[model samples]
Target: MSEFIDGVITEVPQQYSPAGELDHRVHADDHSNDWWRHAVVYEIYPRSFADSNGDGAGDLRGVRSRLAYLAHLGVDAIWFNPFFTSPLLDGGYDVIDYRDIDPVFGDMAEVEALIADCHSYGLKVIIDVVPNHSSWEHRWFKEALTTEPGSPAWARYHCVLGKGVNHELPPNNWRSVFGGNAWSPVKNADGTDSGYWYLHIFDSSQPDLNWDHPDVHKEFEDTLRFWFDRGVDGFRIDVSHGLVKAAGYPDYPQHADRAKRSAGGEIIDFEPLPHWDQDGVHEIYRAWRRVANEYEPMRAFVGEVWVDTAQRRAKYLQHDELHLAFNFGHVGAKWDALDLRERINEALLHDKAVGAPTTWVLENHDVPRVVTRFAGVELPKSSGDGDENESADDALRRLAVLTPEQRVVGTRRARAANIYMLSLPGSAYLYNGQELGLFEVVDLPPQFRQDPVWFRTEGKVVGRDGCRVPMPWRNEAPAYGFGPDGSTQSWLPQPSAWGALSVQEQQGRADSMLELIRTAVHARKSHEAFGETDFIWRDDIAEAIAPGRSDVLVSEHGGAGNRALVVLVIGTDPVDRPDSELLVASQPLTDAQIPGETCAWFSLS
Candidate 1:
């Protein structure tokens, strides 16, 4: 018999075992279909990016208006988060209609125009695809809500019979990633409790689909083709680790040390829980890849996979599977040179084994802004051990309760991190406000909060609203020029101090983060070295600059005659400058020393 302990099932009478082996074999393909390998992709959360209609919300047209700015920023691609038809719960992740655009975001016509505009400006468009779940208002979910058990509509989702005799309890002890029970009890028309329950790994409003059902697979494939037919360059898959759950809704294991590791501190990878990081998820991606390959130029797919280790994360990037998967190790690592170096090496090594390029990201719509995160606020010490789970929402939760932002310190560290990250091999993702040196707006009033996480947790967790605050484009304009003049207040309030951080204020300033990022991005494009997926640590140079010092990290890229070196000084003391043509520096090099907490790039002849 099973018993509930602290809202989790401790044991189950009948347990479902998962498959022991993973099918890691991938399709044989050449390097011709690889556009994202070294691409600089920018993630634009549509709602907070720019407001177009004076409706206090950003729309597709708003993104269309910003094409010139993005083109000038030198990003190869723009990854727009879902503007699909939705009720706006979970920030559009709970997609209601796969084919239609939400009225608030604009219509199908605008999306096509925006895609065309992006292409004209030499930008590839990658839209967010939320395949794990759909909004409750979705036709399938709504029908499942009223259908009888074992019905076809019910089969579309993971609707199962309850455990108890009276069918009062959830089928299993699985808990929602957001909070509360993963199972929501079904109800009759009169609102009486029905004997069936459905699984929702996320919010109750978002129901997890039954991948075992062929209908679910067919629908998503059709959805993919729908956008691909409309000229989307690729897809940024949301919750790519999800979608396939364990066959049986088994009870979640309860243990303080849930992660099993080897003596060397590497995660002894095993299939995670009944809900997450399952092996079956790979088969689905392989099929999706076949579909993507059908197109000319081949639409790419990048998964937002949060697994236990870099090795496990690499599984999603097998040749026949996703083209790229986001690497969170770099984001979750502490702001230490040694820690960052180890993580970078691990990711590069693992990704290289799969013949895939590492997809690096600093911050996103769901995490704390890098500026505030690296600021003086305390971060949990990382033991230089690999924990790939830190890239997910749970890790963000820990950051939600951080100390207030220290603007000067955070901005400096952020600028340095960008220079260092951009110099690394493989692709890099820049969040929308990252270039403006935006820090987390941690002090927004509680009443103004809109993140579903903030409400679901009943104010216990502060949530990601801090990073999702509307962008500040102009210092003096109302709502910082997020919307047109005389527009309604922004959906979320912006900090008053962002006036100095606005693009208008930083545009021409050589010392501004925006200019620095622009310079670094252009350098990455102009140089042939950054195009390759090979970089060697220049330990000899580091020793030459700061003899026997472990604080200075230098990497060399490109060929001998036209090589480039990226130097990062992480210690308190400055290092002697290298004898190379200066390309760009996070901070002004006032003298012959590279200041501590500064990163610089130099051209070597």
Candidate 2:
């Protein structure tokens, strides 16, 4: 067993080896040019990941200290959420300076060291790039606030005159993704309200930049080079579809679906918003792609594009655009066999059309933990009528506290989901704490909540604080060993139950979620079946034995020497295991049957 000193692993246990007794890395030394193609990129919400200095917030040094743990976990890359200079209004998405590191995260030298350390461990680093908007405190926005309406400084953002006769109303009938109006009135230097209202599709503190401006293009291009020159592998472009708006600042349809964006960053009701998924946005990505190609072993770009359909989403993945775009279909799909199959096929088929690899994401910083979402736990309805009248605190109070039985079901399904996702042909993204089987911190005190969504909606929306809770590292240490010794608090409170789910608790256990993920990731990296292969739906599994059984899903990928079979049983009934050599199973199996809510892989060569 690995020994832990204040949640930091003091000794590297044998089981923690990236590869076991046998070296299974098929392409061990091949850090090929296109590493992101099938790479397992682990997403880290820096503030919640680790606290090296016991300052209560996670920082770059914290992440650097945990690099070994990640390497042991067997991910090819680490994708960080924004650590840029920000006001923290939108969880670091409201970037104040694209070129500098936020003090809350660390200094530039630390980031440079982190990048160097990651490369030393054969781990590539992907940082976030928030181009859609700038923080209200950003120098550009402050300048815009001080300048005249049509001045060059103001031209950087969408600051336009309001439509009311007295210039008192917002420019158009648009709603913020967080809540209320999308346009916030600019203030004069002496604090008088300026007639012009600036657009912020999400939070009022995040003013949208005018992408039409040539300076805006030049600025972002320069920022891309700023990081690319620093050995950064790639960037996860935030709100990739919202940079460009329709011409003339067209008014949003009055009766169109105005559903609030989900915690997962998906449009709950995905219609073409006047300011989202516009055709002009592709031009920006195409330009960005050229900048990325400027570096040797060309850097990659993965867009957080949330469009209505798979076809539209694929547009962002064209040849010279983004290398990959997040496929939210997996996160949004119901926990049913047919639903998952459809989502998987849709992503594969559409991404294949564009000759781009499909990216699979189960959970991220913005979404509810899959363990909570898949547990079949439902929050009670509010007494108030709909969201408009709902009290955010009351709704948070009413969030479903998972029952013990629900935890079991959710964990089993989540494990199976990871195995299933990893078996696919393209790249997969793992959120931190997911391997620990951490559930959403639904009961976070209303007073401690900091997400702008909750405050913007006046507590009518609980926001994503639940999923951003600090990671539990030790079962017995203070703050669950999330911070340095003697540290008593984390940025967000962690549940006591997490003591049983911490890394120290599951370090060497054979059946632990952490180990399962490690084993799966190692298998994915070593096995040739996951590399280059023809993906086929294995109807033969059902046709040969469980004929007419729709609950069982089977697929195969890889060529002659590296073929592998995947079997997922989503229904209650057990299915006959594949005749090939058993490689790995999400859960312990009984006899020769794969039980419900279980996924298994087998070597077919």
Runs off by more than 4 Å, candidate 1: 1-33, 256-267, 379-405
- Candidate 2 lDDT over residue span 113-138, tens digit each: 99999999999999999989999899
Estimated TM-score for each candidate = 0.90, 0.91
Per-residue alpha-carbon lDDT of candidate 1 for residues 169-258, written as tens digits (9 for 90 to 100) = 999998777767899988877888888898999899999988899988999999999999999999999999988888877888755466
Give the least accurate 10-residue stretch of model 1, judged by summed lDDT.
Answer: 4-13
What CA RMSD would candidate 2 show?
Answer: 6.9
User: Residue 82 of model 1: what lDDT?
Assistant: 97
* True-structure RMSD for candidate 1: 11.4
User: Considering only N, C-alpha and C atoms within 3 Å, which residue pairs clash in candidate 1?
Assistant: none
